[model samples]
Target: DEPGLRVKLAEGPQKFYIGVDPTGPSLHIGHLVPIYASAHLQKAGHQPIILMGGGTARIGDPSGKTELRQMISYAQIDKNIASQKPQISKLIDFDNTNALLANNADWLAPLNYIDFLRDIGRHFSVNRMLTFEAYKQRLEKGLSFIEFNYQLLQSYDFLELYRREGCILQIGGDDQWGNIVAGMELIRRVESAETYGLTFPLVTRSDGKKMGKTEKGALFLDSSLTSVYDFYQYWRNVPDADVERFFLTFTFLSVEECRALGAAEGSDINKSKERLAYEVTALLHGEKEAVKAREGAKAAFSGGGDKSGIPSEKIGKAELEAGINILDLFSRTSLCSSKSEARRLVLQGGARVNDVKIEDAEALIGMADAVDGELMLKAGKKRFFRIELTD
Candidate 1:
């Protein structure tokens, strides 16, 4: 029922090529959907060609964006690609002979503009290309010529890979349906070969917002960017209405098992959530980190157990000695968005230190407040941060 299915290629053994445009320094949780889909292909004995859009990233893919993306230098693009390689390898088996890791820059960088426009460009019809949703959405807002060429380059990636490795299938999020089909058509026209484009549904919550976003920002795969605890908790806190669908989309659980768990009613849904949280966290951050995060989550919500697993902030010797203002502390440590927000929470009794409600917005904590060299900070019901002082 999801949109964007042009031609369903017959299933069996096939070479699949999936590309990720590294628009940012790190990938968010949304990128996982396609990566998981690629993993599913790898598991089914199909070959996976993981293409990093190093070349296309320079111009940017205009699909599913309201505003134009700022162009990044080649240096930055390489850096982002280097960082993402490991995060992706964690999900897909890159070491196998059936898999390949490629960057489009290898073929796309040295491409002569005029020759490209003459050959590949000649095959594409501008009139028909504009009809695709990707170009249509940006046309009203005035799409750039460079962005307009993005589909051509992406399509060329498929054609190039098809020649080099005989890769015929391309997969990505449904928003990329237009570019994908363009690639398929390119292969058929130029190489006289049949190719396929499969797009998975875009991830969106029942609330009508994209998933993997929070007050903190995007849920990143890298633990340094988004901690394991925060990542685990994001999945743990999914709405009751969405739990059933997410189980199928994110987890590798069998259909019948997911159906049975998702169908559970009322309080029993919490158990389903815990499983979802644990399973997703394990996949992203290994089972050991997931176990620790689970324990920390249990302690945060249940009011007992070791709180070391909870997100902790370390204060300097001078900081602990001088005693920091609670508002400033929360704001600086990213517990609260701003000092004013921290003030509001404190005044409303939503801010607490070591299980004690903060009485004043201007309250400051001195050394005496450091219980056993660590202080537990609670922002409202579910958020917990442990402030530890280095003596």
Candidate 2:
């Protein structure tokens, strides 16, 4: 398939697509693989059709899930797609003549059930579908009928694209291998066209943890979900072994440049990490935000750099004068989601106020803790939040 696909790609501009389901309000770093791959292809002069899975998301993709996906309302799905559009546009140029934004809902939502069942459903085999890893795993945990229909809908999406856009290629995460192949088969069976599918390997850290995962959960592209500072820090703090591979895979940097940067040792490696962090953050959040994030990280670590980039909030001076409980303070910020979590963080010595460890959960944060009308809170070694004392 690779050889044939390469031959086709070498011929000229080919329309290729990658689908993203708006399951969440924000796209996490885990979702970047296919998006980056699409970017590379687009750069190579291939036309990109970014398919928003507004329709298929309703049924929920069962791939890589052990349980049924929580179905979201159509309104929420629309909102999710709108929210993710800008983030995706940072990589793939939707404004370009060669690029297209498509919604499967445009077609999938209006199809008659009986017509679809009789026409498209006839091609799928229950035995063959069950053999796929996605369903096989879900069957043990109880796969829903709706989820079982996801593959068919996804396969039909390919056929639809083939007919409508002349898209001959589908690309996605390796987990989507079965679905991609099914889509290719569907195109062949229905349109009798030779289409292709490409799946990228699952990205993981050298420590065996999934890439883009952080203590707070998945590293989101949305600054509101995961602060730009934290997003930059995730790459900065990546395992030394992953620096090279990440640069090669995530960034649009030349392969030669990525290797040279990855080959750095000792203190120089930190610079490589910083560069990788900056490039990635800049790609997603713009250079200004990336620079701010980098500066924020430096201030957090070096004790004397610009702190404006750190995730921050302002509080009334009277509040600090009256004093706030350590747990309450940390919980109010992004550091801890709740009081109990804040208590654990404090008790575990992961909470700090202006560089001083706060071991007691009941410890008070008062005006005295404020330095030059600012209080810096540290959660663990990496996360930092700043509080400005306002009059």
Candidate 3:
């Protein structure tokens, strides 16, 4: 059962609030749990407020950490906030009658230190605070005063939202339950308001590893950081054990529908994963982009056919005329890890140029290989690139 939070959510003109710290410039798969839940609440006819933790981000939350995160400069924080707006806008309709976007710095930046300590800080207890999981863990690892005060500032943000926006519910991941409960308690003590806190399960891979990360680094929502084709493939290649959960946690598909997809696992799991990838990619990057990304993946993984789906990169005519080695080209485009790896791939019959296998490691590719002025290169079973020769 999803608990009665959704039921209770239906009983009144209630406003729901969820906070996301601008610790990074983009949201990843890790953020989808809360974002999808908030979007669900909105679809169910409740108001949803997304609080951008511009102020608290400066202080840095120490939850699930042994050391304080490096403080981001004010300029950097501002830039991050600006970058996140478009990505968030794609998920929920902010123009809807019941949605809001707020920045905590609006209030936190102007507060008097004495007043904050005398009023807001009065409701918090050191004895109770130290018992929190985040604080207790940090204490063992040497917690700082600035990190210690994080919960207080976060709790104050909740209370302020309740007062100003009439918000009554706060949503976050399970790791944030301690901080969330503190916020609910603060609202009860200071404003005498009955606010609710709901924590969703954190998403993890079947291998018990966290999602949204690869050997390279975090999978950013920004296309510049991760190409749409790569993003689609990330979801498509999800372990069968984790695919259904990804659909449920990341998509608007109902539980019953998700279950139906899960039940077909052994025989048709690939289809389900494809649907998951397409739907999720469409939500983030739009249907057209998702379609193109899917096509690009097929072309890259399916071997040389029509070169239309290959991702293109521009090169100089002089370079092509001079005849570039296939191994060097693969390495330069990041299609493979190193020149040695590229040569190894060619030697193993895993490398191809313009749909033809390259057996010679030192074979120089020239303009003759360029069809319609572009040369398509294939590395192994899942990588494709197009080089455009330009004068």
Candidate number of the best TM-score: 2
The total number of steric clashes, by the backbone 3 Å criterion, in model 1 comes to 0
What is candidate 2's lDDT per residue for 1-391, written digit by digit as tens?
Answer: 8899999999999999999989899999999999999999999999999999999988899899888888799999999999999999999987736799999999999999999999999998999999999989999989988888999999999999999999999999999999999999888888888999999888988899988888889999999999999999999999899899999998999999999999999999999999999999999999999999999888989976679999999999999899999988998998899999999998898998889999997788999998989999999888899999889
Q: What is the TM-score of each candidate against the true structure?
A: 0.92, 0.98, 0.86
Candidate numbers, best TM-score first, in rank order: 2, 1, 3
Badly placed stretches (over 4 Å) of model 3 are: 1-7, 265-267, 303-310, 323-384
Candidate 2 lDDT score at position 108: 99
Tens digit of per-residue lDDT, candidate 1, span 6-79 = 22223466788889877777788888888988888788778899999999998999998866899999999999
Candidate that beats the other on lDDT, 1 or 2, i.e. the better one:
2
Worst 10 residues of 3 by lDDT: 302-311
Residues 1-391, candidate 3: write the lDDT tens digits: 1356656765866788888878888887787688888888788788889899999999999988888799889989989989998888887788837689999999999999999999989898999998888889988879999988889988988999888988888999887988999998999888886778888876779987678886336677987777777788788888888877888888888899887786675659988988999999999999987888877776666644344444668999889889998888888764676898888889999988888999998899888888878787877766667787788
How high is the lDDT of residue 381 in model 3?
Answer: 62
Worst 10 residues of 1 by lDDT: 1-10
Evaluate model 1: give its lDDT: 0.85
Can you rank all candidates by lDDT, best first?
A: 2, 1, 3
